[model samples]
Target chain A: MPFLDEVEAAIPALRRYAHALLRDRSAADDLVQDCLERALSRRILWRRQGDVKPWLFRILLNLCRDEHRRRAARPVLVPIDSVSEAGGSGGQEEFMNLREVHRAMGQLPEDQRAALLLVSLEGMSLGEAAQVLGIPDGTLASRLARARAALRRTTCRAPDRPDDVRGHRP
Target chain B: MTERKPIDDDLLVRLHHGTAAERAELEALAARDPDIRARLTDWQRQDAAIRALYGPVAEEPVPHRQLRLFDRPARRWPRVSRIAATIGLIALGAAGGWFAARLAQPPARGADLVAEALQTHATYSVEVAHPVEVPATDEAHMIRWLSKRLGHRIAPPDLRGFGFQLIGGRVVPSATGAAAVMMYEDDIGRRVTLFVTRESGQAETEFRYSGNGAARGFWWIEDGLGCAVVGDLPVDTLRAISVSAYHDLIDA
Candidate 1:
């Protein structure tokens, strides 16, 4: 496939991954935008590389790191109203359950969360996800286990208090 | 009849992410073990929740800004030339004052080398994948290749005493010529890099300190090559490591 077409095909997955990483809709799209721009500019260098999907993802991950660095001093704020903004299609109960999981996921350390999302959410093989995160397979496995245990604790412990996910709500 | 203990959490996580055979095995075990079945169901529910939360983003139409990148002219050279031309103009603008200072005294070339080293370190140190052109696993070949490219027999200074093991090295462009960077990471994943470039007829100089938040280093001219040790370490710790590297790489 032509490089551009191959990159285009990966856009949806890229958006999903970016969205999962950033947890904010516009910021996630902006990240995807930056990743695509960098990818386009480096088309020549990428031509010699294999597996455009992982490469594109690598670029996205790099940009994501840069974004975090640029905003290191500022905490990312995701407002409650915005959480319900992306709620058009799924059933209300399923959507609320997902929101609970999302809130629980937000509490995870970035490394562990990224590993879980890549393997569980993105359905990537462990090897591929390990490569994407730039960590060893053992490290990725440990992170997945930790993330799962943490999620079970947070999400499963209180099935009733959905709105109290953050615990700061008065 | 003996009851099989539910599989380990690590194995269960792997099974959730494993190949078809492993997944089938998970299913078989879950069929007989209620605990395993409950755990599997919990993970499945989590996956479903995640998919429900963000899967629609994938279904959304590709944003116009992204799709428009392809619509732009596919020619790369024009953009490259435009950037080059802008850089050329910027250099021309800076050269007037730069040359004026050169007439009064010799330019502090060490600073430029340090800046280049810092930039190289900043760019590649955070890389998780493809951190180096040659990985440390192929240490001999990397040494040979880097030495060939650098035009000198340069050794990656042994930093094991400081708990930083050589991860690998890459050849990067420098103001004077090609520069070689050797990256090392300690146990907790903090990285420090040694940047070296050969300069003919250059006089040896003392250490010069340069730093930004969480990244500090010192560069010097020793044995006719510009060398900088950079890391996001404390100034004192970086100094200790740099001093050790200077002796190992420059004096020896």
Candidate 2:
């Protein structure tokens, strides 16, 4: 496939990964913008020369790291109205069930949350996720395990689940 | 050599698959150790919750801004020309000033190097990815690659305790030779760059600050090595970061 087309195809996946990383939809897209522009500008630097998805994601992750660092330097003041604003993505009533899990995921530490988001949410293989994250496989696994434990404590609500055919909520 | 675990790889692989065979083996194992059931259940539930929370993002449309990155010509010569113009202007100033004040040599040269460092920072820091030619994921390779290229043993400071993570280092062409810039990001996405080059003429200068508009810089020289720590952070924070890095990288 041509490079741009391959990059285009990966857009949805990249959006998912960025959304998982940044939490806010618009901010996630901004990070994706930073990633794509960086990738486009540094095309010559891409030693691999093909399949820009992983490279695209690596940049996105690094940018997110910078953004996260910047966020840490300031006083955090989360708007209460932000939750209502997010309701437009999906109807609030329809997404009420998802909110619980989202809240739980937010409760996780940044590293562990990103680790979980990559493997499970993005459905990336452990190896690919680790490469995008620029971490070792062992470190990824430990992060996943820790994230899993954290999520299970805060999010597992079998009693609250709807009568879905599969035991899991989509 | 590292010690090997008793569990076979096949069984573990099966456990990941969650197949009937894997479940049976796991059940047997869980019978021996009850924690296995809890761990498995937790892993499964975590997977489901992540999917529930973030699955929709994949189905959403790609924002126009992200798609715009590819709209430009592949190799942007405009930026290159801009940098060249800036360099050209600097050269013109240096040539014009050489006859004016040869006695005030150190400050002018020092200012120029800081400008170079600041320009490099401004260019590369916006990069979401590929900020460093060598990603911090491969710290050893980054250090080794940078060290070899710079013709000096370079140990990137460990700044995790100060809430800064070393993203990696890269080699760039400098006036002297190839200079090394190690990039770091703190917890909130703010970045601080450490600019390093060999001390020319063995000019060992004292630690000093250079005001850079909204950004700030602190530079020092000791034992034929010079470093300038630059960032847009507030002065005190920048000083703290600079001092911490100096202790870990220079004094140590």
Candidate 3:
């Protein structure tokens, strides 16, 4: 397997994770391209024997973090002008049911979102997820739990819940 | 950060993967506590829906600009090909030794093929409208379009005799170049996809059936083009359709 193929093979997973992190297809795509370009340009940094999937994920997450920092420090410019380009596409109807949950997911803190996505969505074990997120396993676990709790803080507020049940565990 | 009481972690895990009976028992126990049941149901639903929604992104074509990374001039090597080859074998060994443990980790070969088919099925099958790139009314144009993109002359077999009519087709990205996906549907709107990708090797054994997730199909290599007919139909029905298409391709 050439190094190129190995990297190419991981592109799908990278794109999927990037889309989940960034919440926009085109933006996620650009992030994936950026991360892959960076990795390919500096292939020497990757050990030959190391699994490239996690390593690529680590680069992707790092880029996401950098992107967040940049957005926070700089008043972000909205690309409102670009909206005209696809304005007529009229966008297909996204499921409103999913929209409710997606909105809640977007509200999650970035760290907790990353942790939950890796373990719960990507099927990664806690230790491997920690390596990709560059955090201790314990921290990852806490983040995962907090993310679940915070996410359900809204959706799980069923009207059916009894008032006294708030004190009990599910 | 403001803190809230932590939900029992083990309970959450069980809710994520617990038996139906266990879940029922838990629900019964929590009947007095609807908050707990709602929370558990929400978590489990989120976990499943997240994948169902986003997993198809993996099948979206990798943009050509990124793929062009390989077309660039080669960088100087460290002569570590030996180590890479050795490590590759070791990786395969480990993967095979404990496939149960690493099933979540993506594999390099047939898994990619079947997984992509499954994802494609999941994506287009659910469309209420515009399920195909080319509508069946323009089947001729669709074939020409896909063939031109794939750089190989291709045609989709007419399966009207079997009650499946050509709905349309599209060109999708594949490992080597591109694949052609021709979709067909029955009267009730059940869709089946015929996937054709150019293979470097000669045709393989007659036909083999394999499945990933909800997509089941019979895949075979014929005249250096690997073809598969995938759908959610039962194996026998799919196999019958695959055989008909296989004969059509051979005749063409």
Candidate 4:
């Protein structure tokens, strides 16, 4: 019962991280569901003193990675127009920018995307993020740097120069 | 551009863990360096955007359906206990009957067919030297030997459509007297066995799915022959392979 209580307490944070990673409400919920199932099934393996949040997060990260691999193996062709917009401030320009951002996130390598989401979106400390990812701190830093650069190139353009942004070679 | 001071990576790392004095020094350095200022501002903006995107999700209500962690353990225990007891009794009866029947008939009817298939499959699948009693290269001999012992003409199921090759066949004693098992393998080293024996008068023709330990068994009987395919594959994939075997072997 105490373990269940601890898991319940962590659900909101898990949902937040999953939402950021997946960028879709339904997918985020599904990821949270999967994480809970895994945690429950493997409860005996969990150490009582170890942080439950990070353990839950590790399970979530693995599930996301597996889902990504499966989707990559059998790539689906989803039309860009059919992508449901997330809850955000609306304008045609803003919509286009958000869509471009989402596409760019997809193009990022898994490690970089994961690192960025953990540090920036989940508000995890660099060390905690590294631990969750099972990667060294240096690798996490490099991934975060690459993710930041990619986001800048994808999302922001000089207001006066649309063509310049499109034409600028990386 | 005038002489621009280089920003230290150590300074940035420290800034993430710095006191007020360290923060001021970093800010002063950023003020003096245009590139550092630009990079720092870009990093901050990206951080803000990411936070904005995901911050509200942390406050959203978590759906109750997703909270499997809260499932009552007490509720699950009784159901598991009931199933385990039922399976244990069935297994004991089957095993005792099988051993007794093994003396006179050498094999019984339905259960021995499944056991033989599983045993033959396990035995030959591991061998690097002599996997099959008769190799696929000698298909004619393999077919004749198995069909004669089984009391019916049978051929190895063609699984080319499923990306598998016929390995060979073997005759093994089953519950119904004698049974024949044919083996097949895919490129990924997955093996499937087709177990067939003569259907006894008491044997019923009904499809059944059972998981004995980690291995899964799918069985059905038709036309006086008992057939069961056993493997460790996922249920859907196992079902697909079993259906394919049925189609090919029955037609053959």
Candidate 5:
């Protein structure tokens, strides 16, 4: 496939991941367009045989980090609580609503959020996700573990259990 | 009693991010342990909820500005021609493979067609600003573009008699090939969609109803094309409109 077509095909996935990362539709799209414009302008530098998806993701991640740094003082956008009331009718009551999860995700450290999203949501393999984040696999694993533990703690807090549930292990 | 192994959160994290084979091994272990099983299910639900929240964005039409980047005159023509030639060769090879697969594969079932149509309807009908890629005022271009993409000549069915006006349409990717979706709206802003696609080598069938409660419609295959007309209208009204749409398509 032509380089442009491959890049084009990855746009939706990029947009989806960006939305998850930033939680702002227009900002996510702007980040995606920036990443794409950078990628396309430097197309000649890319090795055609190398995988394009991860390369695009790496660029997007860097842009997200920069965006976070630039907006460090501004309060982050959180999906409103009423959004939870709108969906998940019928048998879905057992599942945690998106708004709750989104709110929990807001509390996580940036590294944990990025690591969790790339692996859990995008379905990227551990090794590939590590590569995208420029981290060792072991570090990625711990970040993911911490992220999930934190999410569980926040979303389904059990007052009876000790606070050390996060540190407990086999 | 034997010492029971304490459930590990590390392994649970691995389960969420592991490869398919690794996931299978952990899942098997999860099956034998209730605590682990509950945690696994929770993590899975979290993943599902996250996808449910943001997944639809992936399927939305790529905005025109992003697509236009490829059309910019930044590249020299020589390299462009070389890339075009490579793409042509790839297309030729793919077409050959597709023809071979078509002979071996049966046409998709009616349920699959209707499911795809309803999915397209649910996704696009909610858009307030950019529902249709091409507006109805450019009906000729929209028709020509969709017809070329679908490999079948199609005209948007006139629903004016039923109090709906043609808004426009888009060509969405489908299991069979490209599917055309045209949107219509009554003056009150209730929207309806007609989803049409090519279903080669399929026999004609009567209208089949699918969906429920504010999002419902009918689908059928006729003359090698699978078409569904979906809306929130009453059952009798939807049936009448679908029947009209089917005749319009058949005649066109």
Candidate 6:
């Protein structure tokens, strides 16, 4: 019962993370479904000591990677209308820019995106992110740096935002 | 006055990540240097934007219908039943086929040899001049030659009562190895052959009847030897010929 309750509690976050990774509502839902099913089936394999949230995210991310690999050979076209709809909100230009950032994120190499998402978006510590991605912490840090640089270049935003907490000192 | 050292690339990356201790160092560095503080601000904003784009995805609702984790009762039973029935039918069909084959050919060990002899006799006895390799006039040589080849002594049975004479014998292959068939002819040109070979290691004396083309045969094995009488004669005539041949061969 505790395991099931844990899984249920993780579902919303799983959906959110999957949606970020896949960028398609249906595909994200399907990924979440697969992750949940796998988690349920292999419930006994979960370690009781750690947070189930990261474990669930790890499963979902691995499934997403597998899905990406399977679809790697096939050419995928994101419809122009979906892109426009994603970019339409003028009040949230930054959010729209964020969506473009995600599109750029999608184009970033999978390992880099995975490293970035695990650390920055999912709020995982570098050590935990490294463990989840099955890489060394140093390697994780390098990947995160590369991913951040790539995102900055791809989005082409100014180096500083006035509203940011750490204002430009120079 | 002297100066201190610079940060390495690994340390710069760590500074970009900015742990609690690293943040304090960055604040102190910002008080001392403006350029490093500006880079830190850019890094922080970039981190924030990346977080904003992906952070809310985890809160989205998971569509239950897409999962297919739960099965519908209407669809489940039929598939299982169909698979079970298919397996059952395959097993039943195999058992039935095996039973039918067993009934058609009983477990008699000498049946195959007897059948093979009857088939061979019926096939070759219809030949005119080539029915026997050596003519009956050379009876001793024919017997000795056929006996040497067949690994058993073979004497042509006298079918005088059946109005047939031994024309001669020839060596041929048999199911039990080499065999000899001694040809005989009646007055009307009807020919019958007494097919002989060593018993195929069976103890029972069993008779079988077989027909091919217009020829009928009565074959039996006894005392480590097998014999078949084949001709175009009626059933009674074939039986009579076979009995007379059997008596003469056994007596000899």
Q: How large is the interface RMSD of each prediction? A: 9.0, 9.8, 12.5, 10.2, 13.1, 17.3
Candidate 6 residue-wise lDDT, B109-170, digit = tens: 44565566666666667776587789999998998998888766678887887899888888
Residue B164, model 2, lDDT: 83
For candidate 3, write residues B1-252 as lDDT tens digits: 212333454444443434577657666756765566666666667776566555667877889988887666244343356467445434533223235224433224444565566666777767868678888789889878988876667889878987898988877787757888889899988889888877655423334556655677666553456777789776556766877787567545
Model with the higher DockQ, candidate 5 or 6: 5
- Point out where model 2 deviates above 4 Å: A78-97, A156-170, B1-38, B74-252
Q: Flag the better candidate by lDDT, 1 or 6.
A: 1
Candidate 4 wrongly placed segments (more than 4 Å): A78-85, A89-107, A157-170, B1-32, B74-252
lDDT, candidate 4, residue B148?
90
- Compare candidates 1 and 6 on DockQ and give the better one: 1
* TM-score of each candidate structure, all chains considered together: 0.56, 0.51, 0.46, 0.49, 0.53, 0.47
Best by DockQ: 1
TM-score of 5: 0.53
lDDT by residue for model 3 over A1-170, one digit each (tens)? 55667889999878877777667767787999878876775453355376788878887886777567557768664332121121112222232145545666778877777878887668787678877887776566556766776666655544442431333232
Instruction: Show where candidate 1 strays beyond 4 Å.
Output: A47-49, A73-81, A92-96, A157-170, B1-6, B73-252
Question: Which of the two, 2 or 5, has more DockQ?
Answer: 2
DockQ of each: 0.30, 0.24, 0.11, 0.21, 0.18, 0.12
- Model 2, range B5-91, lDDT digits (tens) per residue? 333222332344344675687678767754455455555655665565566667766777666665665343244443453454335
TM-score of 1: 0.56
Better of 1 and 5 by lDDT: 5
Candidate 4 — which pairs collide?
A: B107-B174, B107-B175, B108-B175, B108-B176, B109-B175, B109-B176
lDDT of 5 by residue, B1-252 (tens): 013356556656655577788889877877897677777777788777766666667877988888888776335323354357445434533234235334434235776887788888899999999999999999999999999999878899999999999999999998889999999999999889999989876765544566644687677775578998899877567766886786567546
- lDDT, residue A165, model 4: 23
Model 1 gets an lDDT of 0.74
| TM-score for chain A, candidates 1 onward in order | 0.81, 0.78, 0.77, 0.74, 0.82, 0.76
Candidate 5: global Cα-lDDT? 0.74
